[model samples]
Target: MAGIYLHIPFCKKACHYCDFHFSTSLKNKEPLLKALAQEIILRADEFKDKIVETIYFGGGTPSILAVDEIKNIIKMLRENYEVIQVPEITLEANPDDLTDDKIKELAQTEINRLSIGVQSFGEKELQMMNRAHNAQEVKQCLQTATQYFDNITIDLMYGIPGLSNQEWKQNIQQALDFGISHISSYALTVEEGTALADFIKKGKYPAVDESLAAQHFDILVELLTQSGFDHYEISNFGKPNAYSKHNTSYWLGKSYLGFGPSAHSFNGDIRSWNVANNTKYIKSLSENQLPSTQEILTIKDRYNEYIMTGLRTIWGVSLNKISKDFGLETSAFLEKQVEPFLANGTLVLKQNQLKTTQKGKFLADGIASELFWV
Candidate 1:
């Protein structure tokens, strides 16, 4: 099944370590939303009639939109696309924007899932990240959201410099206490040109301790597992039957349509992304021209993608599927190469699937890179 991802390229403030494309200005929100609707209608033919199993409203903060604005987009999707009868519609929201009234309004929409950004349960860390929400708001927002929504997932950050292991433990406990069925926890990474990077350069903030980050990751694995959450992806944990279908589709290499600035869309072989500039994207779409660049994945690129995605999930890489898709020789090469990691207890060979062991999860990216086809 296919999916749709709409990027609302606007935020109230910039987080220090964020490298995503977003504007702090709401000057073009209205026009951009309309343009996005048009883009969806215009590009409906791309999917050829695949049922959309998920529709994700992700961004700077989709919760900022009014009830009517959100409903309009849902209406547009229903009219243009072959959406699943009970599609997983998720909206990524910041805690500050999740007022009771807003949550109630959102509950009335076709949107069935809420992914709240509750980065940390520490006020000090929240300020350090320049996040718009405070620790208290995270609890209140989740409590309010639970009143109306059951399919909820929360985004959390871990291993911020100066955030002690105890504090990280508190954050995990807080998420569990809130009764959120799904969680996406990630380590803090300083991207180039981000304020956090500059601060580290100036010795204003401590450099990210890789050792400390690893410790925190281990804590996450232990706690989440004890709490009955499956470590479905390296960063995502879910209770039984609560995995994120939208993101899972991406990892599984299923095709999806992405609308709005900085959004990327994929159809079997080609991938395309809209311009990162919100103004440029809106202007071009207003003129009835979609501003996007396209790339066709070579066989090597496809095989690399498969290897990268397969190793990160519980499902693992299917050697038989790889042989069928890429050729027997390529699969044989991977089988031989992976034997070393398997011998080291970092990889496992079960049935026809090749999966990473628990010890291999933290170094998943490095391991995936080694398996990449030239």
Candidate 2:
């Protein structure tokens, strides 16, 4: 099965730590929507023989659009693609846009999931992140959203400079209180060229502390797992059978088509990404051409990718699958490489699947990189 990702590259304001491609201006809004629809139709042939299982509306900020605009886009995809019956359609939204009325409107659409961008529930953290929604809006949005969407997930961030563990605990508790089924949490990082990075460079803000982030990660896993949420992926927690099928497909190496500016697509081997420029993306599609670049992933590239993605999930890396696909030598190499982590009790081999132990999870990325087929 395959999935479709449509990027809506417009936002009301830029978050201080965000570097995703987007424009605050709505000047090209009409053209962009047209281009997005056109691109979807243009790429429909690629997935013509593939069953489309998921449709994800990701962004700049997907909620920035009106209900009709979203409906039109979903309608276009359904008309052009061989979408499965009762496909999982998700829309990423900001809390500010999800008023009670808006939430009610969204529930009537084909969209069945809401991935709200409630980065933090604390007023201080909200202001620090330059989020469009305040603590009150966050609460109000969740209260209303839970009424409509059962498959709801909220984004949460940790490791803010002044956010104490007590505050973080409170944040986790608040989400639980709302009965959100999924939680995708991440430790805030400073990306270069973002306002947060500049602030740190100019000594206007404190640099992110990794040690503190580690502490928060521990707290997050402990609390969520105790609450009966599965830490299925390093950055995601979901109740049983409520994991994000779209994202889980990515980790499992499924093919997907990504449309609009700055979106990426994969076809089991080759991976491609569209230009980040909206004007260029629209202009190219106006001429019925794709404005994207692609690369054919080598065997090593594929193996390394599987290793990186597999190690981060509870499914883990399958030794037998590696041996069958990458040959005995490569499999032997992996087994040797994994020894250090296994010996340290950071990794465990269970039923031929190598998975991270609680001690190794926070360091999964680093460990995966070391075992890369360099």
Q: State the C-alpha lDDT per candidate.
A: 0.91, 0.94
Give a tens-digit lDDT track for model 1, residues 143-233: 8998899999998888788988988998899889888899999999999989999999999999999888988999999999999999999
Candidate 1 lDDT: 0.91
Q: Candidate 2: list runs displaced more than 4 Å.
A: none
lDDT of 2 by residue, 192-266 (tens): 999999999999989999999999999999999999999999999999979999999999999999999999999
**Lowest-scoring 10 consecutive residues by lDDT in candidate 2?**
40-49
Candidate 1: worst-modelled 10 consecutive residues by lDDT = 40-49
Task: Return the lDDT, model 1, position 363.
Answer: 87
Shift in Å, residue 220, candidate 2: 0.6
Which pairs clash in the backbone of model 2? none
Cα error of candidate 2 at position 211, Å: 0.9
Model 2 gets an lDDT of 0.94
lDDT for 58 in candidate 2 is: 97
